[model samples]
Target: MNNTPESSFERCPVCQGSGSLRHLVTIREVPYWRCERCQCTLMDARCRLSPDDEQEVYRLHDNQPEDPGYRRFLNKLAGPLLARLAPGSEGLDFGCGPGPALAMMLREAGMQVRLFDPLFYPNHGALAGQYEFVTCTEVVEHLHHPLETFSLLDRLLKPGGLLGVMTCFQTDDSRFANWHYRRDPTHVVFYREATLQWLADHFGWVLEIPAKDVAIFRKPLSQPPVPGNG
Candidate 1:
């Protein structure tokens, strides 16, 4: 495989930083690039699947709400988030897949939850209001425009609210070629811990890694006026 830079791939989709991305590797003929500025890896845009094809791939996932193993998987994000959320706090489950097991779990925990997914739910109105907490589990990797999507997440969150994200962190570059996470064609972007930290700094949110592959960011609360400054 030729490792030369592709002309069309100029900027980092996550940070919008130009000249900072280098051709990382080609796996199964799909080109992936690494951005020095944000420390995130992304698949070449040209290689992404079309909407119909992507939806078809998603349909194959059997993430049922009644599945005990699936609930345990979602609990990784839910446990920490529920610990911080107040009683009856409103939340949004961004990119809730077809089954929406996470949303079900949150609702059962005494919270008002709304669902949003471009392919599954497609509720445009759901994105209009801010919430006390927003959860994006196993979803960021599929983002085509991550920068904009993250900005939207920031907008969706209320002051001092929490944004819980769960994704398999890309730690070892040597194994990236054969990594199962990268093998999924719909997964266009890969994030490292540094990449998540960059997002926290960019959005002015405080980040916490409560568990492996789970990051919770708290939107900073408005500071009170200093004494004698008013």
Candidate 2:
């Protein structure tokens, strides 16, 4: 794809912003654009892998639940979230992937963890339940429609629930071209601190950045009144 603003054909998937994407950079001949409104970055759809190919790539991942290193990696999100939960709280591990390591960790802490992954678990029943917390570690970047995913998460949580997200954040436009995280073909959408803040503001959730790659959004105890609701 051409490295130009005119080449950004897709609307900003997060905020639905239009005509605001500028070609930010290209890497390995794949073009990416940045949304002016939300600061979310997107790869050209042409670069996305086919489902079979994507699954093949995922099959190569070394995310072994038994691996101590992997467990520690998951603790980055789980540690903070666990501290906030009441004893024996129920939670869902969204996009638990093949190993469901985070789910294992949470269960080990006495919290009940339901696992769901579009590719792996596919437990549609899990989607019907409310939870005290929901985690989506390293999963948001691959969402083709993050808006819908976020909406589902919001609806799935009980009042004052926590939504924990773990993904490497896009730090700067200049560094994007060579960023190792961007090299993954399955990773389509990218988030920045500002992009997550936009989500928090729009969804009436409180945002927290507990770590460099972690975002924790707390659902309000009561739904906020819509504009002009009085």
Candidate 1 displacement at residue 144 in angstroms: 0.4
Estimate the overall C-alpha local distance difference test score of candidate 1.
0.90
Instruction: Find the candidate with the highest lDDT and give its number.
Output: 1
Off by over 4 Å in 1: 1-3, 223-230
Which lDDT value does model 1 have at 214? 99
lDDT of 2 by residue, 1-230 (tens): 74353554557778877787888777777888888988999998777899999999888887988899998888999899998899999999999899999999899899999999988899999999999999999999998888879989998899999999999999887778778898888899999999999888878999999878999999999978422211
On the 0 to 100 scale, the lDDT of residue 220 in model 1 is 82
Every model's TM-score: 0.94, 0.93
> In candidate 2, residue 75 scores what lDDT?
90
Q: Global lDDT of each model? A: 0.90, 0.88
Report the C-alpha lDDT of model 1 over 1-230, residue by residue, as the tens digit: 95585834667888888788888887777778999998999998989999999989999998999999999998999999999999999999999999999999999999999999998999999999999999999999999889889989998989999999999999999999889999898999999999999888777888999999999999988733212200
Off by over 4 Å in 2: 1-5, 8-10, 225-230
Flag clash pairs in model 2: none
TM-score of 1: 0.94
